[model samples]
Target: MPGIEAGGIAVVLVARSAIAAAPRAEMERLAGQVSGLHEIALATYAFTEQGQPALREVVANLRRRPFREIRLVPLLFPMEASFRAWIGRTLARWQLEWDTEGPAIRIGPGPNASERLTDLVSDLVETAGREKPFMPAEHPATTGSVVAAAHRRVLVCQGGPCNEAGAAAIWGHLRNEQEGQSLRTAGSGMMSATTSCLGPCSLAPVVQVWPEGTVYGGVNEAGIDAIIREHLLGDRPVESLAYPANGRKQALRLRE
Candidate 1:
């Protein structure tokens, strides 16, 4: 992004998706500040399946446009130690996936923008001694004894085995699917949580549904859709994909 040309440049504000993240409007405000860019977008590394677009998806779409270059502004700070390197490798992956001709891809904001962010951080740190008091009414942690009206509870295994077997991707897909099906709403009667393990470690990427306690094995994007649409929303477990191992057949029998 040299010579300071105005048009033909696309800027993307990229971050890793997280649960209950800060407002998208805040990021939009930042993107709007810069002028003369061909296009500006927001993308994430697919931590959650919310309103954010995947980095790969956004890059691909921007490449279709006649922009001279695509710039990815990393919005995530305090990321994992390997995050910067990971971003490089991810861009490499995108290049390999789409081998056709496209604009040059570069990561990070220009120096002036980076300096502004640095100054903002410095100002915040200069006043870091003042602590904001927590408000319990705004963010209550504990609930009363009243029983939940939810009809089903889903537990996605995050055990060591499952994590190695793609539990993170599964969780992301599940989040998107849950949102698509409107299952996360308070009145949806559907609840979901992450669990350490669900037994049947043989079925490493397991998803368990409550009431009947049916454990699903080898879940993927399609499996998540089936679990939400056919199982939770349809009131029936996807039996074919269900792995009733480790004595859980008894719990599944309750449904019969």
Candidate 2:
């Protein structure tokens, strides 16, 4: 697509939850160097769950801004069917909610698993490796600092359906548990992150424990404690809440 006029158009990079932060920062930095675009923003959403600044949220925020044309670029590797459906639904909702005088909306294709994207990821990894080492938090002694890589990463889905299904509460509980466990203490070896979606909306409010790749569905506040105690702390997944890998639906167990 052609570059937009200086003050009339905005470009929003819609990214997946996993690698969104760093790439969004990089894209914003690059977009700032380009002349003509009114504003460059980042909106992250999940295919099956509720992510922050979802498309609807992004549109609402953009309408409050000064731009007349809003361009949405999906940072997906492949524009899958679910992605198309979600984007179409989101735009339709926007059209229904806003007037014609609102900012014109446009959707751009994803990166499509291109070699360029692969190269970019490679470069990012190499660059990060060469950069300064990570310091988890401020500390007096350097030897006691916790490194994120050494921790077991827990990703909680905060996508739309999940959010509607009370994923926010579940996330809060998880965060509280994470802090309560003192996982960030020197050798505790546990960390948690909030993700946009995990691609299973029917099983909303999901939590995935990485390295183990165990996904728990329909998680609630009560389940959060079990997840932390059994999985994060004990290294044994709570199979009762675990999402089956074979695509079979288990009975919903978490409290609403």
User: Could you say which candidate leads in TM-score?
Assistant: 1
Q: Report RMSD for candidate 1.
A: 7.8
Task: Give candidate 2 regions above 4 Å deviation.
Answer: 1-146, 186-188, 247-256
**Local accuracy of candidate 1 as per-residue lDDT tens digits, 1-256:** 4244333677777655644546566665666775434344322232322345555567778778677787777666654434445456546645765788788888774233464778877888877757686556877668668565788888889887666665655676676657666786533477777899877666667899888888888775567888887887778789867866555443222221
My TM-score estimates for the predictions, one after another, are: 0.58, 0.41
Which consecutive 10 residues in model 1 have the weakest lDDT in total? 41-50
Question: For model 2, how does the per-residue alpha-carbon lDDT over 39-117 read when each residue is reduced to its tens digit?
Answer: 5432223212223434455666666765667777776665664565555554664466465456677877677646588
Error of 1 at 214 (Å): 2.2
**Number of backbone-clashing residue pairs for each candidate, in the order shown:** 0, 6
Scored against the true structure, residue 209 in model 1 reaches a CA lDDT of: 88
Candidate 1 clashing pairs?
none
| Runs of candidate 1 exceeding 4 Å displacement | 1-11, 16-22, 33-74, 81-121, 127-147, 160-166, 184-188, 199-204, 247-256
Clashing pairs in 2: 49-159, 49-160, 50-158, 50-159, 50-160, 51-159
